[model samples]
Target: MGNSKLYKGSLSTIILKLLSEADKMYGYEITQKVKELTKGELQITEGALYPALHKLEAEGVLEVEVARVDNRLRKYYKLTEKGKEETVSKLKELQDYIANMQVLFNPKFGLES
Candidate 1:
Protein backbone atom coordinates (compact mmCIF):
# COMPACT_ATOMS: atom_id res chain seq x y z
CA MET A 1 0.00 0.00 0.00
CA GLY A 2 1.13 3.52 -0.72
CA ASN A 3 1.62 6.22 1.91
CA SER A 4 -1.50 8.12 0.83
CA LYS A 5 -3.65 5.06 1.34
CA LEU A 6 -3.01 5.37 5.05
CA TYR A 7 -4.59 8.81 5.14
CA LYS A 8 -7.24 8.27 2.47
CA GLY A 9 -10.17 8.04 4.83
CA SER A 10 -9.24 11.16 6.77
CA LEU A 11 -8.60 13.53 3.85
CA SER A 12 -11.87 15.39 4.11
CA THR A 13 -11.63 15.68 7.85
CA ILE A 14 -8.12 17.00 7.57
CA ILE A 15 -9.14 19.56 5.01
CA LEU A 16 -12.10 20.64 7.08
CA LYS A 17 -10.04 21.02 10.20
CA LEU A 18 -7.47 23.12 8.41
CA LEU A 19 -10.09 25.39 6.90
CA SER A 20 -11.70 25.79 10.29
CA GLU A 21 -8.44 27.15 11.60
CA ALA A 22 -7.18 29.06 8.57
CA ASP A 23 -10.55 30.50 7.46
CA LYS A 24 -9.60 30.07 3.78
CA MET A 25 -6.95 28.39 1.67
CA TYR A 26 -6.10 27.52 -1.90
CA GLY A 27 -5.35 23.97 -3.05
CA TYR A 28 -1.57 24.29 -3.09
CA GLU A 29 -1.64 26.11 0.23
CA ILE A 30 -3.63 23.32 1.77
CA THR A 31 -1.19 20.72 0.51
CA GLN A 32 1.81 22.66 1.77
CA LYS A 33 0.21 23.21 5.17
CA VAL A 34 -0.52 19.54 5.56
CA LYS A 35 3.04 18.68 4.57
CA GLU A 36 4.40 21.20 7.02
CA LEU A 37 2.19 19.99 9.86
CA THR A 38 3.01 16.36 9.19
CA LYS A 39 6.72 16.99 8.83
CA GLY A 40 6.58 15.77 5.19
CA GLU A 41 5.27 12.34 6.10
CA LEU A 42 1.95 12.89 4.30
CA GLN A 43 1.27 14.53 0.97
CA ILE A 44 -2.12 15.27 -0.55
CA THR A 45 -2.07 14.67 -4.26
CA GLU A 46 -4.17 16.70 -6.71
CA GLY A 47 -5.89 13.50 -7.72
CA ALA A 48 -7.24 13.10 -4.19
CA LEU A 49 -7.62 16.70 -3.09
CA TYR A 50 -9.74 18.16 -5.91
CA PRO A 51 -12.35 15.46 -5.85
CA ALA A 52 -12.72 15.80 -2.12
CA LEU A 53 -13.03 19.56 -2.38
CA HIS A 54 -15.66 19.30 -5.10
CA LYS A 55 -17.62 16.79 -3.08
CA LEU A 56 -17.62 19.01 -0.01
CA GLU A 57 -18.68 21.99 -2.09
CA ALA A 58 -21.53 19.97 -3.55
CA GLU A 59 -22.57 18.97 -0.06
CA GLY A 60 -22.86 22.60 0.97
CA VAL A 61 -20.12 22.24 3.52
CA LEU A 62 -17.55 24.33 1.70
CA GLU A 63 -17.73 27.65 -0.10
CA VAL A 64 -15.39 28.54 -2.93
CA GLU A 65 -14.05 31.87 -4.07
CA VAL A 66 -12.08 32.38 -7.25
CA ALA A 67 -9.51 35.14 -7.64
CA ARG A 68 -7.10 36.01 -10.40
CA VAL A 69 -3.55 35.59 -9.20
CA ASP A 70 -0.43 36.00 -11.34
CA ASN A 71 -2.50 35.75 -14.57
CA ARG A 72 -4.29 32.61 -13.40
CA LEU A 73 -7.47 31.88 -11.53
CA ARG A 74 -6.93 30.52 -8.07
CA LYS A 75 -9.75 28.78 -6.27
CA TYR A 76 -9.88 29.26 -2.52
CA TYR A 77 -11.97 27.14 -0.18
CA LYS A 78 -13.45 28.01 3.18
CA LEU A 79 -15.81 26.27 5.53
CA THR A 80 -19.43 27.17 5.33
CA GLU A 81 -21.60 27.42 8.47
CA LYS A 82 -22.50 23.78 8.10
CA GLY A 83 -18.87 22.90 7.66
CA LYS A 84 -17.92 24.70 10.85
CA GLU A 85 -20.39 22.55 12.72
CA GLU A 86 -19.19 19.46 10.92
CA THR A 87 -15.59 20.28 11.79
CA VAL A 88 -16.32 19.90 15.50
CA SER A 89 -18.03 16.58 14.94
CA LYS A 90 -15.31 15.28 12.66
CA LEU A 91 -12.57 16.32 15.06
CA LYS A 92 -14.21 14.50 17.96
CA GLU A 93 -14.60 11.42 15.77
CA LEU A 94 -10.96 11.53 14.72
CA GLN A 95 -9.79 11.87 18.29
CA ASP A 96 -11.89 8.90 19.38
CA TYR A 97 -10.51 6.84 16.50
CA ILE A 98 -6.94 7.67 17.47
CA ALA A 99 -7.57 6.72 21.08
CA ASN A 100 -9.11 3.41 20.01
CA MET A 101 -6.25 2.66 17.65
CA GLN A 102 -3.77 3.35 20.40
CA VAL A 103 -5.47 0.90 22.70
CA LEU A 104 -5.55 -1.74 20.01
CA PHE A 105 -1.99 -1.28 18.80
CA ASN A 106 -0.17 -0.68 22.02
CA PRO A 107 0.60 -3.96 23.74
CA LYS A 108 0.91 -2.38 27.16
CA PHE A 109 -2.29 -0.42 26.87
CA GLY A 110 -5.25 -1.87 28.81
CA LEU A 111 -3.80 -5.37 28.58
CA GLU A 112 -3.96 -6.30 32.23
CA SER A 113 -6.84 -8.48 33.38
Candidate 2:
Protein backbone atom coordinates (compact mmCIF):
# COMPACT_ATOMS: atom_id res chain seq x y z
CA MET A 1 0.00 0.00 0.00
CA GLY A 2 3.01 2.25 0.27
CA ASN A 3 3.33 2.39 -3.49
CA SER A 4 -0.36 3.11 -3.80
CA LYS A 5 -0.07 6.08 -1.47
CA LEU A 6 2.81 7.48 -3.50
CA TYR A 7 0.77 7.20 -6.69
CA LYS A 8 -2.16 8.91 -4.96
CA GLY A 9 -0.10 11.93 -4.00
CA SER A 10 1.25 12.31 -7.53
CA LEU A 11 -1.92 11.42 -9.41
CA SER A 12 -2.71 15.02 -10.25
CA THR A 13 0.69 15.50 -11.81
CA ILE A 14 0.24 12.33 -13.80
CA ILE A 15 -3.16 13.35 -15.10
CA LEU A 16 -1.97 16.82 -16.02
CA LYS A 17 1.04 15.43 -17.85
CA LEU A 18 -1.11 13.01 -19.82
CA LEU A 19 -3.62 15.69 -20.79
CA SER A 20 -0.77 17.97 -21.77
CA GLU A 21 0.28 15.46 -24.37
CA ALA A 22 -3.16 14.32 -25.51
CA ASP A 23 -4.81 17.76 -25.76
CA LYS A 24 -8.05 16.66 -24.12
CA MET A 25 -9.56 13.64 -22.36
CA TYR A 26 -12.36 12.51 -20.11
CA GLY A 27 -12.15 10.83 -16.71
CA TYR A 28 -12.24 7.19 -17.76
CA GLU A 29 -9.89 7.89 -20.60
CA ILE A 30 -7.39 9.39 -18.20
CA THR A 31 -7.60 6.34 -15.92
CA GLN A 32 -7.24 3.95 -18.84
CA LYS A 33 -4.31 5.86 -20.24
CA VAL A 34 -2.49 5.63 -16.93
CA LYS A 35 -3.23 1.92 -16.69
CA GLU A 36 -2.00 1.29 -20.21
CA LEU A 37 1.13 3.35 -19.69
CA THR A 38 1.95 1.64 -16.41
CA LYS A 39 0.93 -1.80 -17.72
CA GLY A 40 -1.62 -2.09 -14.87
CA GLU A 41 0.85 -1.32 -12.15
CA LEU A 42 -0.98 1.89 -11.32
CA GLN A 43 -4.70 2.28 -11.12
CA ILE A 44 -6.42 5.60 -10.48
CA THR A 45 -9.68 5.26 -8.62
CA GLU A 46 -12.64 7.47 -9.45
CA GLY A 47 -12.97 8.50 -5.83
CA ALA A 48 -9.44 9.87 -5.86
CA LEU A 49 -9.25 11.09 -9.44
CA TYR A 50 -12.37 13.14 -10.03
CA PRO A 51 -11.87 15.37 -7.03
CA ALA A 52 -8.35 16.21 -8.15
CA LEU A 53 -9.59 17.01 -11.63
CA HIS A 54 -12.31 19.24 -10.26
CA LYS A 55 -9.71 21.01 -8.14
CA LEU A 56 -7.43 21.56 -11.11
CA GLU A 57 -10.28 22.99 -13.12
CA ALA A 58 -11.21 25.25 -10.26
CA GLU A 59 -7.58 26.31 -9.92
CA GLY A 60 -7.47 27.34 -13.60
CA VAL A 61 -4.96 24.71 -14.61
CA LEU A 62 -7.55 22.97 -16.75
CA GLU A 63 -10.37 23.95 -19.03
CA VAL A 64 -13.43 21.80 -19.39
CA GLU A 65 -15.78 21.39 -22.30
CA VAL A 66 -19.04 19.56 -22.22
CA ALA A 67 -20.16 17.60 -25.23
CA ARG A 68 -22.97 15.19 -25.86
CA VAL A 69 -21.76 11.79 -26.84
CA ASP A 70 -24.30 9.05 -27.36
CA ASN A 71 -26.90 10.95 -25.34
CA ARG A 72 -24.53 11.36 -22.44
CA LEU A 73 -22.76 14.53 -21.39
CA ARG A 74 -19.05 14.00 -21.33
CA LYS A 75 -16.73 16.58 -19.85
CA TYR A 76 -13.32 16.83 -21.44
CA TYR A 77 -10.34 18.40 -19.80
CA LYS A 78 -7.53 20.21 -21.59
CA LEU A 79 -4.72 22.22 -20.20
CA THR A 80 -4.64 25.97 -20.39
CA GLU A 81 -1.41 27.84 -21.15
CA LYS A 82 -0.89 28.15 -17.42
CA GLY A 83 -1.49 24.45 -17.18
CA LYS A 84 1.17 23.73 -19.79
CA GLU A 85 3.64 25.81 -17.83
CA GLU A 86 2.62 24.07 -14.61
CA THR A 87 2.95 20.69 -16.27
CA VAL A 88 6.54 21.37 -17.27
CA SER A 89 7.38 22.68 -13.84
CA LYS A 90 5.61 19.86 -12.02
CA LEU A 91 7.33 17.25 -14.19
CA LYS A 92 10.71 18.73 -13.35
CA GLU A 93 9.86 18.70 -9.67
CA LEU A 94 8.70 15.08 -9.82
CA GLN A 95 11.84 14.12 -11.71
CA ASP A 96 14.02 15.72 -9.08
CA TYR A 97 12.11 13.97 -6.33
CA ILE A 98 12.49 10.61 -8.07
CA ALA A 99 16.20 11.15 -8.56
CA ASN A 100 16.58 11.92 -4.88
CA MET A 101 14.71 8.74 -4.03
CA GLN A 102 17.01 6.75 -6.33
CA VAL A 103 20.01 8.04 -4.48
CA LEU A 104 18.50 6.86 -1.22
CA PHE A 105 17.67 3.48 -2.71
CA ASN A 106 21.10 2.91 -4.25
CA PRO A 107 23.38 1.98 -1.34
CA LYS A 108 26.62 2.75 -3.15
CA PHE A 109 25.56 6.33 -3.98
CA GLY A 110 23.34 7.13 -1.02
CA LEU A 111 24.03 9.33 2.03
CA GLU A 112 24.64 6.24 4.15
CA SER A 113 28.35 6.89 4.09
TM-score of each: 0.90, 0.91
* Best-matching candidate per lDDT: 1
lDDT of 2 by residue, 1-113 (tens): 32378898898899889998897999999989988888888888889889999999998999999999999999999999999999999999999998788887895666654
In the order shown, the candidates' Cα RMSDs to the true structure are: 2.4, 2.8
Clashes of 1: 0
Per-residue lDDT for 1-113 in model 1, tens only? 33456598999999999999997999999999999988888888899999999999999999999999999999999999999999999999999988778888985765752
lDDT against the true structure, per candidate, is 0.91, 0.90
Once fitted onto the true fold, the runs of candidate 2 whose alpha carbons sit more than 4 angstroms away are 1-3, 107-113
